[model samples]
Target chain A: PDPALDDAIRAVIDGKTKPLGALGRIETLAARLARLQGTTAPRMERCTLTIFAADHGIAAEGVSAFPQEVTVQMALNFLAGGAAANVFARTLGVQLRVVDAGMAEPVDHPALVQRRMGPGTANSAVAPAMSPETLAEALASGRALGADGDADACAFGEMGIANTSAATLVIHKLSGLPIATLTGRGTGLDDAGLSAKRAVLERAAARTGALPPEAALAEYGGFEIAMMAGAMIGAAQARRAVIVDGFIATAAAMAAQAIAPGCEAAFVFAHRSDEAGHAAALEHLGARPLLDLNLRLGEGTGALLAWPLLRAAAAMMTDMASFESAGVAGKT
Target chain B: PDPALDDAIRAVIDGKTKPLGALGRIETLAARLARLQGTTAPRMERCTLTIFAADHGIAAEGVSAFPQEVTVQMALNFLAGGAAANVFARTLGVQLRVVDAGMAEPVDHPALVQRRMGPGTANSAVAPAMSPETLAEALASGRALGADGDADACAFGEMGIANTSAATLVIHKLSGLPIATLTGRGTGLDDAGLSAKRAVLERAAARTGALPPEAALAEYGGFEIAMMAGAMIGAAQARRAVIVDGFIATAAAMAAQAIAPGCEAAFVFAHRSDEAGHAAALEHLGARPLLDLNLRLGEGTGALLAWPLLRAAAAMMTDMASFESAGVAGKT
Candidate 1:
């Protein structure tokens, strides 16, 4: 964090409010933003949601019961207004835009932003998957799309079958942690399937060279993860609140923070997902999620569930009557 | 729980919408109200929040670190707009009216409704708390106040130090459960305090006779709990959605349900509380709480936290485009 931003945040904390640190993380986030932007009253406007759609090469590994086609189907569901994400975004009054960074088929949705870097990468078990150029393009696409939204803040969500495997690989590579620590049964995988996922990830890591801050990302990262990382960096530069979803989004956020350390100031962990890896990711990010519903659907549902709390937090900051104004005595 | 109201709720579940049970408890509540009042739309308007304030005699038991005076002080703070509940009510655009059902000291806030039935109850450890006449008057006062609000829906909140013991006793009597099973460390009480609280409740129950339902309430209940029960019943007679808060409100709800079986149609359990007996109370009432944050700090904080989710559920019911309207195919 910048010293000036840190100072500004402390000043806001010391401001004449109801009580010092009564608002919890909401107050902390607001204060940090105040310092970052050099404004006492930092407002959240132009809220944008980036739904990255990709096809995990690991889906071809038979690790998922749901076929790879479910990825495209769900992405279409998102665009055609049938998915839970659609209902949630509608309720939150936030704009939703889809990105086809590496879907298996040719993108057709008019609403979806066609930012494909490849048809899909090779299976990570066999090789280093995506090339550096493809990775760079995916990152650039995320940055460009985030910029296009002119978003005050952005949330990172994904739709990709077998993507949890990809997320595991990314997390393991980034954190220098073993695959066993970060791996989980994605979408109800059995114990055997989990073991298979761990083995696949370990082999993929061996094939890939020294994790090049960004190189490991290209080798093991899904297009959606790379793009989300890019979007996070862009949103951070724009000084927007990056509301992160569950395990996959947290992994992307970790990668984003690695590339651009300043992005941590702009992120808020929306909820503690039921996914096992989620706790590790949140701990790694030093984030406190708003809700814990044991939810693991992973279609930005947890983030959307927490939108009301965010609204409440912001409302408290903006609407609550100060002690002086309400003619009430402060706690002694 | 009425046959007609149950049928109406069933009709709502069978309505032409998404899945048969997708909307969950929301559709049930709306439909039950429709049957009770014989209206299709079943609108919830003129929302009233009655915060019952009292001083717990248990404070004299050395159970609480804070004195009984804090209850009066906080009640005044609520009237003066210094409490968390005040900030929450203002933010949610709900009308909050405070009622001093039992306070040792008189508060001079002009906004506070002076409805004191007595100075305070005797400590429950020794004898019956309040006289039957006082309990009846408290109940009547609550009913009158609720009716005056013209509330299409009502929410019940309470403010009293160490009232958790009072609530625990109510829950034990109402649920016919053992005190040990329901007793919890109220407001960060130690294990020793909890055991002592259970002993106190058992001793109180042993002394108190099973007076008539209303008379029993008067004899054993606090002025605030009795008043809240009356308000809940009144709100039901007026065909309003009664959003019940945590443990204390649940205890009052149980009392209201006992008095007026039809009032069950008007009740909606807002959220599950962190209190040990809260779930038991909810189960006794067959109420499904919306949120379950391990929060035991009453003063309607749980209900306030759930207000946004309630709004979201309502918004989904009213605003989301149906499959036909959005021109989208439902998932097979």
Candidate 2:
């Protein structure tokens, strides 16, 4: 980000006809967008939400509340325009894309982007989630997908049973936070189910120690998570704003930030999730999301919901009249 | 609002293809719209943002940051589509209406609605802010304006100089909160300005121990505030959802609720403002706003920014598929 450009944007925002700083966080958001685009006025006219769907082998350990088949079902739901993501995307006029990264049984829809790395990742509780070759393929495929879109911003979502467990272990290894603190109810888990999931994640964490980011992904990350990380990096390379969804998408962003340290400059976190460990994860990244509606459903729904605020901020920069232009008196 | 219909809406929301309560506040918002409209599916397709502009008598006490003439200037700004409210209303497809409730100087724009009771109100710190006849005229005029729109939802905004002072005293009288606690820097006041404002409001509060709602409005309310209160009640009576804006608008809502006890059922608080005592005012009404962007720019901008979320919620009710229809398995 250019400090000079940021100062210029701030000056313009301050000259608006409202009280100094009365626009509040919206002023801050406008400045951030301007600095990212290196322009006085930025536009968020077109946005695309990419939902990466995969199955987690960790589901074999009974980690998620729903069975693994739900992943493919949701992928099909997205293609059929029947999911929450589809509804929100339609409401906001956002383009929606669903990708099948690696499901146990692939959905055969013409609209589904097939970028499968394997049937699914191996269960991390007993072994590494994926081979290094599979990890490389996933990252490369996601980079291509992210680079192909012409939208000004790209939002990422994930659909995988037991993926929250995968995200928790990945984050625990990356940040060294406690396993119990980072684990939570995935899709409405009962107390016993939550405890059991935490115990299983502990077993997965015990299998490795102090691994690099790549090794961490190969060991603990699901196919969709690794791909989303690479997609985020690629989107940043293309200079598009990376709008990260809820907790699982945050895990992908954490991985992306680790792999490409400067790519997080493109990230605009959408909301703080009700999921356990989300707040800690956000704190670790020094990120504050735009909305906090206790949203935990994650098919890029939260990211799509925040799209209007970005538009409003950009419009404020481009459309609002300055005090002098509006012939209004300034503060005494 | 029907209790049985609310239960039916809740059931419909739960049966959507996501987990129970996964959509967070959105689920609650959908149910609220449904209950308010007395339907399982409510639509927010058309919305109107009515900005009531007036000059507050409190400005004579030096309680505001700007001169009272800014009110007429902003009303012209709104008519010219150069203000933040105009931009947001355009972006959200909401109709924008500018009402000259009782500005000291009337704007000559062809689109301006002239509902002037007088050439402004009297100074409230020394005497009554408005005559009883003026208050009654303002309410009736606002009621007619609110009931005349063909919109599913109505949002209220105020653009009156020193109106925050008027709202502070009005809320203090109605809510019985301490005047000092309810006073704040309206539009970027320095510490000394804030102290001066608080002292003036305390003096106004001491003018009457405990007045009836109408008497208090005549003694301390602005024409814009009285009009907005009447507008909210009229919109509720017309079965249109009422979206209340920041500090001044909340004070109007408080008065509206006091005037008609059940009118608040149609109210949807838009955002928590950065202004002081806004949280206390919201608490007094038992309200939790949909957004919290620290926005203090009134002109209905905060309410307009929140319009997309309401649309998404309504779309979720009308569009999203149930698990049975999508053939997705339930939680195991």
Candidate 3:
């Protein structure tokens, strides 16, 4: 932890707000921000949510029961405010922008921000799917959105069929873990399907000479994941708290961490999911998940569920009657 | 479920404000209320949180590491707004009222409602300590608070040291399950402590004759538990949603359900807890917990943590754009 940032955070906690450390994680995050900015009472206005929609090359391999077209449908659904994610964003009173970073179809929804790198990447099993230029474009798009949102806090969520397989490959390559350990039934695949998915990921991992972390992501990463990694870095550079959701978001966080070490300071693990690799990914990042519901429904649902706790934490920081304010004797 | 209440609930779900069946649980709760009250578009304006603070007789048996005095201290902590529950209630803008139905000390906080049934009960190992009169008073106090809040929704939470042992006994007797299966280390008790706790509860159950259902509660139940049960029944009578918390609260729900079969329609399990017996209690009530965070931290932390999801469900019911509204085609 940066000492200056730590001090700033401590000051916010110690401020004449609520009780000291009353707002558990929210206070912790706010204080950390105060320290990062070397100020007390750091403001957290202008929250932004970046919804990255992509199609997984691995989807063609039958990992998910839903066809790859469902990804495009859901992405369009997101833009149309019909999906669970859209409802959550609206309820949270947060600004939501949908990005079609790698959709196979030309997303016609007016609400969607068309930043397509291509009509989706080539199948990961065959070769390095996304090219260097596409990866760079995805990253640039993420940064551009962060700047555009002028977000004081930002979160990244993705919508794509079989993206978990793409995330599994990303995690295996980045964490240097074997495919079997990291891979599981992505979106309800059975034993045989899981085994086939693992084999495909292993083949993809080996094709790129265990492509050095950053290069590996550019090689095997989904357009959404790489772009989200960029968004994480951009949010951090802008001094915003980056709330991360389950497996795929963690993979993006890892990529972001690799690219910009300082970004870790801005990240908070929202929840531990039922997904097999989520725990390992959380452990690797030394992040404590806020909730541990067996939720595999991604689209930042887990994060949205955890939002009230965050607000409570902030409220505790701002409203709790501290030892001094209440004139209560502290632990002797 | 009442046929009238069921029809009322369906009407709310089919209201012109949103698409059919899009609001999910919120719509379900509203529709259930419609049937219960014979109206549609039921509103949940006034929300109440009845926090029951007590001292467990089991605490005298050295079941918990924290001294029994800590219960009073924490109860005071709650009234002083220094506890996690206080911050949560404040953030949700919900009214919180603490009831000292079984506290050993004369609760000093002016904010607390003095509904003390007794100073405290005797050790359950000796007998089914609380007399019928005291249990009745506690139950009435809870019911009165529920009515007074005029709440559209009500939630039950507790603040008592070593109360988990009391809850365990309630679970075992209510579910007719083995004490060992239901017992857990309450508030971080170790293996030895747990074994001793289990033995005490088993003995208490045998001594009490394990009274039948609701009647059993008067024999072995704490003031807080009994009061919460009354509150649940009162909320049901008011046609409000009763958001049930973990073990102890679920025990109250069970008692309420036994006394008033119609109350089951009003209850919503907030989360599947890490507590050993919580799942069994929820299953017995045919309730589905909204979140499953493996969290056993009592004091309504889990339920309060889940409030956002509940609000989101309501928001989705009220805010989501239908296919027609968004000009998007619905999936066939």
Number of the predicted model whose lDDT against the real structure is largest: 2
B238: Cα error in model 3, Å: 4.4
lDDT of 1 by residue, B110-224 (tens): 8888988777787877766787778778888887766665655678789877677787777777678777777766655668777777777788777765545676575567889
Tens-place lDDT per residue, model 2, B101-120, is 98998678789988887788
Candidate 3, residues B176-292: lDDT per residue as tens digits? 877888787656666887788878777777886647765677666777888889988888887777888888888888888887777787777887777677787777767878766
Give the top-scoring candidate (TM-score): 2
Q: B325, model 3: CA deviation in Å?
A: 6.8
TM-score per prediction, in order, is: 0.75, 0.99, 0.76
Q: Name the 10 consecutive residues with the lowest summed lDDT in model 3 chain B.
A: B15-24
Worst 10-residue lDDT window, candidate 2 chain A: A1-10
lDDT by residue for model 3 (A94-166), tens: 7777888878887777677888888777788887768787788888888777656566668778877778888
Error of 3 at B290 (Å): 4.4
Off by over 4 Å in 1: A1-46, A106-111, A144-152, A176-206, A209-212, A283-286, A321-332, B1-48, B55-83, B90-127, B140-154, B161-165, B168-217, B232-244, B253-297, B313-332
Q: How many angstroms is the interface RMSD of candidate 3?
A: 6.6
